[model samples]
Target chain A: MGHGPGYVEADEDMSNPLGLKAKLGLDVFKHDKEPHITIKAGMAGDQRLKKAIIVCPAGLYSENAQGEVELTIDGCLECGTCLLACGSEVLGWQYPNGGAGVQFRFG
Target chain B: MSQASTFDVIVVGAGLAGLAAAYTMAREGLEVLVLERGEYPGSKNVTGGRLYLNPIRDMFPDLWAKAPLERHIAHEEVCLLDTEGAVTVRYDGAELGTQPYQSYSILRAKFDKWLGKQAERQGAMIVTKSRVDEVLFENGAVVGMRAGGEELRTNVVIAADGVLSFIAEKAGLREPFKAHDFAVGLKEIIELPRETLEARFNLQGDEGVARLYMGDVTKGKFGGGFLYTNKESISLGIVAGIEALNEAPSTIAASQMLEEFKLRPEVARLIAGGETAEYSAHVIPEGGLHAFGKFFGSGILVAGDAAGFSMNIGVTVRGMEYALASGYLAAQAVIRAKQKEDYSAAALSEYERLLKESFVMKDFENFKDSLHALENPRLFTYYPRLAGDVMRDLYEIPAGPKARIFPTIRKYFSVGELWGMGRDMWRLMKI
Candidate 1:
């Protein structure tokens, strides 16, 4: 079963009308929209790094700290732990290309 | 008749669905071959790691005595969490701890691999690391499949290749899945000492609790998150609509959303010292009635995720059970088709009949409204926001005389401005 109305729409005032309401339109923001990232720490903006590294950290959808598993097990969290560990700036950590990543049945 | 070197039936994918099919076929004296793409049968597979025992027991009588089960859960808890507070419902019955009932937590890598071995003992040939490239057809009838560039012919091909089933698409049995048809599930298996797990969750030896967290898990973006207990590991995950995440703002990546969930004061308390053991993600088919297509066609039968048999609407993500059931039914259909010397789509249609006759299709038909109900946008959007809004006022504990409950209740209803709660209630009733 899903959250009872008692649980989901519990407090009316505690809710922030801004971020809370905007986040509701995830579908509108995701596919129809795209994200713009300004890379400052990685390789130079113009120069092409020879290695196209993918930083798949321990938490496939979350970042991890230093002492974590480095190998990819089909379900990497994209946590950026390895990216920070590698520090090579070669690892390009982003969500799975598309249609790939974690799924949830309820929120 | 073509004298193929292989066997009468070739079951592709040694996951639970495929293994169930192969085991059933072999028991009936049919030569069955299970080809797995993974290095081992379940090595590439992952699940929430809990198995409701009744279904498994129905398939294999007294299976609990022999199946490779991890632990039988004695307790279950459902916790509804917001950014600040949580409300929990717990069900603990000793009866749930015993016979013909109760669910066991499992690791697919171990469970599926063991089940494959069971099928082998029953005379099924399981070939691992053999990816089925395509299904072979002669005169527009499925005869076998291509594995690693080699053609292996058989009487029937059972497609149980999971959510992104390539074989189903290749055979023209199904269309490509849309974002609305599925959810992307991410999970982490965190390991805690055996004693710690029991103590943390307030459980005895094998008892466990499964918690479902809503609200901030996906940063209040539609889908929900879950945490289930195993013997010594906790399976934590977040699953959301693919389209929803694509729509979120750039400041919050999906990963950061999950981070926000774990970092929440309520959720963070649970996994305080646990070390992460494994992380995995798999596409879960959430499409209910609208997603189910033809169950069989052209000398082949589609089972499990390939047929969009997953039931993912709040209560449970139920493809594995349906997979095992549909796979067993498919095998029976193939056996009948072989006996009648007919592998036409009409003959394979029996599989569909059996599915409808079983809980697989029956439940889907019964709860068909769930798809539209969940997709209504109000559940995730308006509901969570309104809930957080009201609770903010109700929970303020004052040191002086307690504030009258009437004003807070009035405030709660007034701020939920859209449609009245009555409309949502009516919609749920109609669904």
Candidate 2:
């Protein structure tokens, strides 16, 4: 299902994950900001399940070579997808400081 | 304890709800303060971006003349897509384009900012870029809000904060919304030249179209997709209940679902030559009243998405109306509470009373079944495909005797599918 015509490849000129974000003017997102989420150390060690790596809407969580879940907090959409998907046992979710996170131009 | 730290009412979040509530209170001559976490109101929000005006007309009678409205939606459609083609149910009329219009598409940043300005003019203090870290309490009664390491007192605190509001949790009203209780949405505002947009969408000046897509968009998930036209831009996106999404046979990412929908020839044409303008994702409450939190407790009253006032009523998903309505009601309740000199849960109960007495509650009651029908995968998946197939067969123009419409539709529907739809129809009648 992933390979066939059932799947539509994003335009070649477009970047799958970010081309849209760039056009959305998210490049000016508050990148130099505080982290609103705390990923438990060795969360990947349990390896029981790391759904956050796959389920985050922003694709913010990815597995590192060391089997650690590396999170790119700067691009976090703050939609709380990962927060809800991660469960409290694995993550500490908090809103970004008053004005220190991704901002939507037309939201 | 200086006067500067006190207010008659304080609203958290400056989205439609907070602004409406603040404006209502301010208009009553109460000192209202609204703290928004965004750089400006709506900087952290996302919407399919359409505001149905009839519901909010009383709150802002001359909204059309003063609000930063994009366009009055005169054209609307529901596009059912199978793999290669689409079956569209289009509705258009001059009546829909008249004053006190059916609806208008909006950009939250612009609309919310305008709303905040309106509240300010009515004596409300709208503080953008200030987040309410938590709800402040005194002697087990909600009293004010703490933000940025500072505590400010208010006779009442209205949590107009969006969904996933920690303020709700801070008040012990409820925990963070679970994935099953809500759907995650991702949207992109594509910038298009007005002439090109008008030409492609067959729109005249200041006219717009809103489209809701089923099938193939969410890859047959419980939620669907939307395309709303804003004067020079188009908002398109998919919303899938995270529970259904996580349970799907495929691990389709949200962005992948949107990309596939954008690439569909049916959608591509409408957005051709348009530049991607904004990308955003938000969590919308899907579960109706069942998943909603308490309306008021002590001095804290939760409204908007924070209280789960939004709904996904089949094809016409609604939030802004409920948010604005609840905000208006909450403000009215706060005014009454101040008059009674009691912000207790009992005194603030008026908020829920106003809601129960308004369409906000009645509509939720009325559409409970429709929402039920929508949650059934068949509504978004099987039925659209079946409808699309029947529509396809009817119009294929093959050189043969024409097939009867009933049998043609039945040919695509199994006995079980028929039963399900029959039940859906019956339940819809009850609604």
Candidate 1 chain B minimal-lDDT segment of 10 residues: B247-256
In order, what fnat does every candidate score? 0.01, 0.59
**Clashes by residue pair, model 2:** A24-B277, A24-B278
Model 1 TM-score on a 0 to 1 scale: 0.78
- Per-residue lDDT of candidate 1, residues A57-95 (tens digit): 122222235322223223333232232323334334333
Model 1 ranges with Cα > 4 A deviation: A1-107, B1-5, B93-95, B249-251, B376-378, B381-395, B415-419
Per-model TM-score of chain A alone? 0.28, 0.69
For model 1, what is the alpha-carbon lDDT of residue B395? 81
Query: Can you write out model 2's per-residue Cα lDDT over B1-431, one digit (the tens) per residue?
Result: 32344688889999889988998889999989999988888788888878887877886664558889888889889988877677899988778978768899999988888888888989999887787876778898888877887878888899988888788888998855666777888888888888888888899889888899988888777878899889889998888887776775777767767777888889888888777766788888877867777878898999999888888876688999999989999988998999988999999999889999999999887776555666666666676677767778877776887767787766657797778779877766644
- Residues B11-82, candidate 1: write the lDDT tens digits: 878877898899888888889888876666775577775777675567666345777666676776655565
Using Cα atoms with residue i matched to residue i, what is each candidate's TM-score against the true structure? 0.78, 0.92
